[model samples]
Target: MPTVAQIEQALFQLAPKDLAFDWDNVGHLEGSPDQEVQRVLVALDVTENVVSEAEKLGCQLIVSHHPLMNVRWHQAEMQTLRPDRYLGRLLRRLVKADISVISMHTNLDIAPGGVNDALAEALRIEDPGPMPGDETGLCRVGRLRNPVKLSDFAGEVCKALHANGVRYAGDRPVEYIAVGGGACGDEIDAVIAAGCDTFVTSDLTYHQFLDAAPKGINLIDAGHFPTEDPVCAKIVAYLEKEFPQLIIIKSTSHKEVIQYFVEGE
Candidate 1:
């Protein structure tokens, strides 16, 4: 059984925690280096639900995409209820319960065979190239073997990734696609640079879509939660192989971020 310190060292090789932005909190928000973890879980967000799920699954550590403390934190102890309205509050609860946390954000973005490339593969892309953004290179581009209409291709991204909903811009046949996982509204440049007929990612704002519309790029916004949720299982699988004795569990909160309901006539 690998100790927490040993496991953390291994993770740094996979996705270096120092690679996280100076302002971004990325590594070891809670727990101690000396602590021994018997079980762990992974999730996109470290919400209250996530902590509860970890407890339910008997996990002492949780590796999440979003950091529990993204800003400068005063203390690690949870005295009064943290009114910050951030993931810190949840982190406090987990800390009290001795649950460790590590967030893989930007480091995961640039990691080879990581989220961007994995998403591109899920989209049925061939020879999906490196990340294309000058800043925060999470966007990946490549060609689809068979061309499909904007709507059809967007639907495929949604369906294949088990996405609840997706938003798009433009209306023609889409051949090339640029993909990024989790809130890629800022990947417009990658779309234009690659001259892709379509771009698929999560979280496209109205302003973002409008900006891309003039460029004549078909942008598909697969919901953030759905697009990145599938990777948690992969994380667990990776860690399980490394630490065979430690239990690696997946999150149970498998619901769409947006609750969509259309009234039947």
Candidate 2:
């Protein structure tokens, strides 16, 4: 069995720590590094349910896209653990279960074959590359195999990402495309600068859609969880290959929490 530190090392290679934004947290955030791990669970977020699932599965470690603890929580002043709070409750559960946590946040988003790339592949974007003029490289620019109407492409995105529904703007045909998994709606300017006629991402504000429509760019807000969840499978596959002797599973109990409703349904 591999130690938690060993698995963390492998993950660091997959998404180097330096690639992570300075303000973002990544790598091993909880539990003993030297703890041996025979089974691991992967999930997009380390929620209460995910922690419970890890306990039930006998997983020694959980590898997640989002950090279990926020950057502010790492402060010495915030170190007082209170079980009443959400993060505090989850932390207590994890500590009791002896489940370690490793987060691959913005680094995973910027890494090759990571979140953005996985999303592009899901949408069938051809020849995906780093978004131009975006130093963070949190987004990917590419072209679809063929041009399609914005409405048609939105449908494809919803289906591809398993989104309950998608909110979109613009009526132009989509060909060149850009993708940013999670709350990357702010990158619309970079998407336009990259010459992408369509931008597929999540967590957009109404103002963003309003601003984008007149700019002749198609924007699809596919929901944050849907956009980033594809990378969980990628993580599972990578870890399985790296540690063939260990059991690595994507969390079956964790999933998109949001649902959509239509009138008279």
Candidate 3:
């Protein structure tokens, strides 16, 4: 069985710590580095439900996309860990269960076959390449295999991502496209400048949709979890290949936490 540190090292080869943003948290966040691992649970987020699932599956470690500790918790003043709060409660559960955690955040988003690449592939973007003028390289640009009405393309995105629903804007067809996995509404300007007629991302503000139609860009606001969750499977496959002796399972209990409803439903 590999130690926690060894598994982390293997993960780093997939998405290095140096690739993470300075402000973001990545790598092993908790538990003993030397602890041996046989079963690992992979998840998009380390929620209470995910932790419980890890315990039930007899997992010795959890690999997640988002950090167990929020970036806000990295501040010096926030060092005092309280068991009463939400984050505290989750941390307590992990500590008690002896489950080690490793996270790949911004680094995963920026890696070659990471979040954005998976999103582009999910949406069927052809010949995908890096978004032009994006210094962070957090987004991808490409042409759709065939042009379709914005409404039609949005349906495809929903189906591809298993999204509960999608909100979109713009009257034009979707052809050239750009994709950023989560909370990338701010990249619309770059999308337009890169000559992409469609942008697929999540966590858009109301104003972004209002402004998109006039700019001649189709904007699809897929839910945040849907946009990023696909990468969990990618991580699972990578780990399974790298550590053939270990048992790797993607958390079946984890899914989009938010529920959507239609007016007539």
Alpha-carbon RMSD to native, per candidate: 3.0, 1.5, 1.5
Candidate 3: regions farther than 4 A off: 73-77
Least accurate 10 contiguous residues by lDDT in model 2: 71-80
As for candidate 2, its clashing pairs are none
Q: Is candidate 1 or candidate 2 better by lDDT?
A: 2
Q: Residue 51 deviation, candidate 3, in Å?
A: 0.5
Estimate the TM-score of every prediction: 0.88, 0.97, 0.96
Model 1: weakest 10-residue lDDT segment is 71-80
lDDT tens digits, residue span 130-204, model 1: 645546666777888888888888778889888766777786588877777887766777667767778787777
What is candidate 3's lDDT per residue for 41-152, written digit by digit as tens?
9999998999999999999999999988765654642465677767777888899999999999999999999999999988889989899999888999999777898999
Q: After superposition, how far is residue 234 of candidate 2 from its true place, in Å?
A: 0.7
Superposed on all Cα atoms, model 3 deviates from the true structure by an RMSD in Å of: 1.5
lDDT of 3: 0.91
Order candidates by lDDT, high to low.
Answer: 3, 2, 1
Model 2 lDDT tens row, 232-255: 999999999999999999998888
Question: Which residue pairs show backbone clashes in model 3?
Answer: none
